[model samples]
Target: MDHIEGEPCQDIEDCRLTDRHVQTLLNREADELARHFTGTFSPETVRDCVEDSYTHLAATARIRTHLPVLAARFARQRLEATAKNQGATMSDEPEVLFVCVHNAGRSQMAAALLDHHAAGRVTVRSAGSAPADTINPAVIEAMNEIGLDLTKEFPKPLTTEAVQAADVVITMGCGDACPIFPGKRYLDWQLDDPAGKDVDQVRPIRDEIDRRVRTLLDELVPSNA
Candidate 1:
């Protein structure tokens, strides 16, 4: 995963936080995560995941108020991926990861569409080489118009564990950023970036992604199978 150099605190409230305060919050989050991943991971591992997730998300976060919550969610995802990599959790469903430059537009759209179409038949994740602070508003609007909600979705940094856990890795435009591993299927979809575009402009891109997602779904989980 690419690291963006910066302090984690960017918002006004975040700027007011002391190092101790941030550490305390992270410790609390790690405790909760440790309980959730009890049998699968150790406390130290959980704490490290939490701290790393916080740093990754905090680097691009525009608001610090919800940093802990977001960090928890991100850490959980990474831990789950790590579990999959370590064979701690087994799944028959295919795991897919979508990567792009800024997880704000193309990658996010593809992930949501694939999840919707998969309907729990497949596991989906998305990340970026350089994540944005928030999801692209136009992408959100376009997805919403199709009955998919993305208001809670945020950009996530790409991670080695995420790639290692995935059975299929799709790259939108991040190009050479995604790490390659043997036996994993890789596909590059040349899609237009939705940043700075309005909802109308994003709709076509969303539809195209939907079409591609459906095609991929057929290959991964065929109707006959």
Candidate 2:
């Protein structure tokens, strides 16, 4: 229900996000996020996360109409990773995180394929070293061919908390962007970037990722065992 009432801001600088009206929306978002993480994170922590998320997205987002909703969603994902990193939440399932230069392509495909294969047996997350404003249309089409939907997914920035939360961190073509931490398993996957490719070109990349994802799932949650 959180929405801006007027015309969407054409530019990030033109958006008066500090105005009273927008402030009220942010306050509501903070309150909602605080309640959602009542036990694991403090209200102040949630507010900070919400504010930071908004600022991060606002820097790259072309439109400001759905900024509040996107910020809230981003904050929730961060808070979830934080909770897991801090041991405030515990799960038996292994956590996996995929990283690439732009979350628009390879990482997205890998994460989705892994999630589909793992089902409820693993927790999957994907991020980018330098995230794109939107997902690659060709990548979305490529995934759709196999019945996987990427319409609701957005390119998310890579955060240290996300890496810390995952038991296995898979890096595609992001190089040394991801932070190295002790007690974590890191794997570098040499995959082609799908930034400018068409659906046909992306299909082979998608299939390769799918094959690798299935192999990873087997290792993580071996069905034969």
Candidate 3:
């Protein structure tokens, strides 16, 4: 059997350590790990990303030699993502903000598809030049066909804040109403507004958006995925 030293379990019976004890041990372990975790990390990156990793370490700290390996993996991933973001003016990943007259149909569908396919590799936002009452029914139906969920998403208004927040702003038939700002990148996707289109027509629009989404992912993200 393996032998280890240091503190033992408290009055809690099972293997779970006492809360206070864990917190104290966590602070010590964090200090120990700092020697390796620091350096070359991005200043803009949030500290919680590295600090929170040690919160559960008290239970495993008896053999802390294993932590350096895990810390290396975490540090590498965080550093790479930070590096990819440093080159961009807005989002760490290419943030594509989709806008239309009402954010119910075209823009919502585009954003949802991209988020589904790209996941962590891409940042996506969708809003309307003028907010809509609710998401279009047909749009939800079409998206459900592909197993994408938009339950938590809602129509948001276009504003200087939202546009400036994005790396790429795509407008779909929003006319001149779309927010414009100096030095902000823009694209007008002439996708036939899906507001009242039949399922057949909207299907093609979804397909085209998917293709563009894939291409954008290839260019912006490190992987072909």
Candidate 4:
């Protein structure tokens, strides 16, 4: 669903996160990384990367069920890429492209969250496989709940240039719509479509997205910077 559509949901529950949940997710992720990098990298490196990845995502994610697996996969891909590109001179800024069917809801929200949380550390963009005319209204309200104004954000069509420019290309159930480029990281987020859901339903989706976005930013623009 585009951000231009949807009804606001009242009686929104206060979404709070807990420390145990975060630690558990990280532990699983670290285990996943260990399996992949056991002999290639030291345990300390794997543990540190796993913790960083979890910290980045857990802060904003509202849904915890699949977070650990997602975090592990994401962290693994990033670590692999970083290892491959060691000693290479990379751009100071990392560009991430978020894509979905309409570019109205998920992609827009993800882009905005990354930008908001990154604070100029990352270059964020969003586009749709089939572009929509306006932002989803329900999505706008959901973001507004967190003091993020997405009224100015509009749906954009996917472009070769945009995809090529991105250091990472993330698709939210967009299927095979996004083009494949060599040496670029790609991820597909299996998220629910917010088309017919009310603002209440959208809230949790938004929160979960924020968590993923935060985690992505941590990887792209490290805390040390």
Best by lDDT: 1
Candidate 2 lDDT over 1-225, as tens digits, reads 233434433454544356676567877999998998998898999988887787677666656667777888989999999888777898999999999997999999999999988878999999999887789999999999999999888888899999999999999989899999999999999988888889999999999999999989989999975
Cα lDDT over the full model 4: 0.72
**Structural similarity to truth (TM-score) of each candidate:** 0.91, 0.90, 0.57, 0.60
Off by over 4 Å in 3: 1-91, 222-225
Q: For residues 1-225, what per-residue lDDT tens digits would candidate 4 score against the true structure?
A: 211113221212222223567567677678767877766777677777666554444433444455556556546655654553553235568889899998889999998998899888887778888656567789999999999999755555566656776789999988899989898999988888877788999999999998888888878878996
RMSD of 4: 16.9
List ranges where model 2 is wrong by over 4 Å: 1-19
Weakest 10 consecutive residues of candidate 3 by summed lDDT: 8-17
Native-to-model Cα distance after best TM-score fit, residue 111 in candidate 4, in Å? 0.4
Candidate with the greatest TM-score versus the true structure? 1
The digit string of per-residue lDDT tens for model 1 on 1-225 reads 232234444443443334677788988988998999999999999988888788778867866667877888999999999998888999999999999999999999999999999999999999999899989898988899999999999999999999999999999989799999999999999999998999999999999999999999999999899
User: Which residue pairs of candidate 2 clash?
Assistant: none
What are the runs in model 4 whose C-alpha is more than 4 Å off? 1-91
lDDT of 3 at 151: 55
Question: lDDT of each structure?
Answer: 0.89, 0.86, 0.61, 0.72
